[model samples]
Target: MAAAAPALTRSRRPRLGALERRNLRWGLLFISPWLFGFLALSVFPILYTFFLSFTRYSGIRPPVIIGLTNYERIATDPLFWKSAYNTLFYTALAVPIGVLMAMILAVAMNQKLREVGIYRAILYLPSILPVFAISLIFIYLLNPAYGMVNALLGLAGLPSPNWLGDPTYARISLVLIAQLGAGQWALVFLAGLRGIPIELYESAEIDGAGAWTKFRRITLPLMTPVILYDIIIGLSLGLQVFTSAFILTGGGGGRGGGAGPDNALLTYVYYLYKQAFQFGQMGYAAALSVVLFVVSLVLAGAVFRWARGWVFYEAEDA
Candidate 1:
């Protein structure tokens, strides 16, 4: 029985060959570099920044140990509130309008019509334009007197509001321009729209459905996933809007370069940029970044939650 027990054990348990074990180890080893890089670059930096947020550090010098002073200051800071308000305003305005416009353009581009390529090209060109250069062009276009926009307004006997210069219009100008250059988003929507099968639309048409009814029942429901995707992206980008605000609000290198007019166009990221690079308050900026991180996480989670009910993923069709 004892001799048979040893034979049974040997038969039941077979050790991996040295070469196979070596290959397994090497597989893990290959991924270890990526894991290490992710830890150092992605994870550690995030932790370090969160720690720094509680301290005070000018970019030129070492951090001074402080306990929640920056957070406390930000809690009561009017400029912080102003920036938050402007960011929220931008997010609110840009998300729905931009998404709707993008979807509209995408649907138009998806039609089997002549010159569709030209239409698509023209629509997407603005997205690739240098943002700063686009802002410069818009600056001249929105100029009070000599601008073409105002000139058209004058010809129509309408009042021309100063776009970048006026407090009332400053934030709206950013929102408007963001909407205007939604070409990239349009392309994304176009891709999603094209992915929808023609059979469903044909079936709806065969059922004697009207154009509006067919769209409402087939197009919109199936497109909900893409719509939700656009919402998440638009919210995140709009909340962090910087380039348009930076150009309109006088660049972020000095205190004078705060938001335009009454700080109407100041976004969360623009404020954070001003704090870190311009004011050299790296700690406060880190704290702001942390806040932004939390807010973004929350927003993303909310979108996912809402999408669970609203969005019709491809898997749902199966």
Candidate 2:
């Protein structure tokens, strides 16, 4: 057994051949730029932010050590709580709605129609446009008076409530605006839909399974993995939401420069930006960044853990 253990170790750590070593060196050389960028841009910044979280750096002056003061203040800060609430609310509503809309569009796009390609292109056009540009366009569209949306509502004899200006409807409007990007995710779903075996549907048909039954049993189960992917990506983007809100709220400047009316559009990342840039609270912003990083990690971990039960993998069953 002792002799076998040595043999096993040697087998596991077998020396690379000359060609293998040469290939490994070439691969490393090819990837050196990415490695350097990752270390300098990502890893160093993350470590520095963690360090700054414990200090009082205002971007102009040297960072002063302040222990847990910034974190402790976070617990008592009303704006912090409000931003957190707004972010959570937006994410909760937006992610599910976005996922569902993407799935619906994917289903529509997958239909065997003559003009399907044109429809798909039109649906996906919004996703290619710059988010800021889309936000600007939405600003005009969602205007309470004379806006196309409000004009249609008025024609229908419905109240044209202020969308971005009203606190009650501000976040909801953002949620609706988020759907414009659903076409991108729809493409992902369309790929998954295409990957589904036609044989499965044929077999279900032979077994006298209705279209709805086949969809519920086979289509949905097979699509679970794609749905899981969409959910995680949506969650991450929803948490980091800023551009739309910033542009819609006119650079987050209305009513005491609160992100929006009553800070309704004051998302967590926007608050972080205000701290780092607008208010010059770099250390506080660093602490906020750290907290956000931790929260994102936790949420992603939780989603992965929860997905184990529902995210069906065909290979696992096979």
Pick the TM-score winner: 2
Please, what are the lDDT tens digits per residue for candidate 1 over residues 76-169? 9788888999899888988999988998899888888899888888889988887777777777888888888889988999999987778768
- Tell me how far candidate 2 lies from the true structure as C-alpha RMSD in angstroms: 3.8
lDDT of model number 2: 0.89
Please, what are the lDDT tens digits per residue for candidate 2 over residues 66-181? 99999999999888898899999999999999888888888888778889888788888888889999899989999887689999989999998999888869999889888888
lDDT score at residue 77, model 2, on the 0-100 scale: 87
Per-model C-alpha lDDT, please?
0.83, 0.89
Cα-based TM-score, every candidate? 0.87, 0.93
Could you tally the backbone clashes for each prediction? 0, 0
Q: Which residue segments of model 2 deviate by more than 4 Å?
A: 1-14, 252-257, 316-318
User: In candidate 2, how many Å is residue 239 off?
Assistant: 0.9
